[model samples]
Target: MTIKPIIIIPDPLLRQVSKPVERVDSDLTHLIDDMLDTMYDAPGIGLAAVQVAVPRRLLVIDVSKEGEDKQPLVFINPEIIRSSEDRSVYEEGCLSIPDYYAEVERPATVTVKHLDRLGKEQLTEADGLLATCLQHEIDHLNGVLFIDHISRLKREMVIKKFSKAAKSKVTV
Candidate 1:
């Protein structure tokens, strides 16, 4: 498995909605392995295909605590089937956005339906950090970023900061 390069913010491709996976094949499985490798290498709890410049409705997550056994999960064409009205706030971060983090409020519990690596349909009821991570990664599949959940002013500031950083790298 190869660790793919994660595309940082200010990249237009990150805003593009991902396409659904057509079928589960060897190539798709290979990509899943690579995604898992990339996510682990990133030292992040979750990652979306778009973060690696792949416009596919796929995401990998491992919300296990540090030093505990990893419980990697793959979601293809994931959709939130149900969400509780109860709200919860969690400090969220994304690999695409690097070190930036913000407390985002969302449903305390969520039921997501998606295809597994074998293409079998599965429904997962998630809560706590798992729910937050699933929501965050699923948002990526729809071309949404965690920052989009924050205030307008803060979102613009973050965009401007990353835009400036991207420009500096080009000139250097």
Candidate 2:
């Protein structure tokens, strides 16, 4: 599987809402494989298709700790069906945002409905890091970023920083 280039902040594509996956074919399967490869290569727990400039409602995640067996998960057209009122905070990072991280509060548990790798419908009840990762990636599908959960001042500062870096790369 190929490791795709991850699009960073200030890239308009990263803000684009992803389209739902209509079917699971060989091409879709290949994309899933590539996404998993890309996520692992990024050394990140989760990744969304939009982060790779693919406007598809797909995401890959592996929240396993180092040295443990990798447990990769694929979610297509994922939607949060239910979420606990209980809240939790995690220092969240995104591949698209690179090194930036922020404490984001979200539901402690979530029930997500999505299509499995085989296109079969599945509902996953997730908690802890898994729940946070799922929520983060699913937010990407809707053109939302983890920074959006932070204060507006901090979010703007991050966007400005990345925007300047992106400009330098273009001029260089």
- Give RMSD to native, each candidate: 0.9, 0.9
The Cα local distance difference test for each model comes to 0.94, 0.94
TM-score per candidate, chains pooled: 0.98, 0.98
Which residue pairs does candidate 1 place in steric collision? none
Deviation in angstroms for 132 in model 2? 0.4
Worst 10 contiguous positions by lDDT, candidate 1: 163-172
Please write out the lDDT profile of model 1 over residues 1-172, one tens digit for every residue: 8999999999998899999999999999999999999999988989999999999999999999988998999999999999999999999988899899999999999999999998999999999999999999999988899999999999999999999999999953
Write candidate 2's Cα lDDT for 1-172 as tens digits: 8999999998988788899999999999999999999989888999999998899999999999999999999999999999999999999998899899899999999999999999999999999999999999999999999999999999999999999999888853
Instruction: Please identify model 1 stretches exceeding 4 Å from their true place.
Output: none
- Which stretches of model 2 miss by more than 4 angstroms? none
* Model 2 whole-model lDDT (C-alpha atoms): 0.94
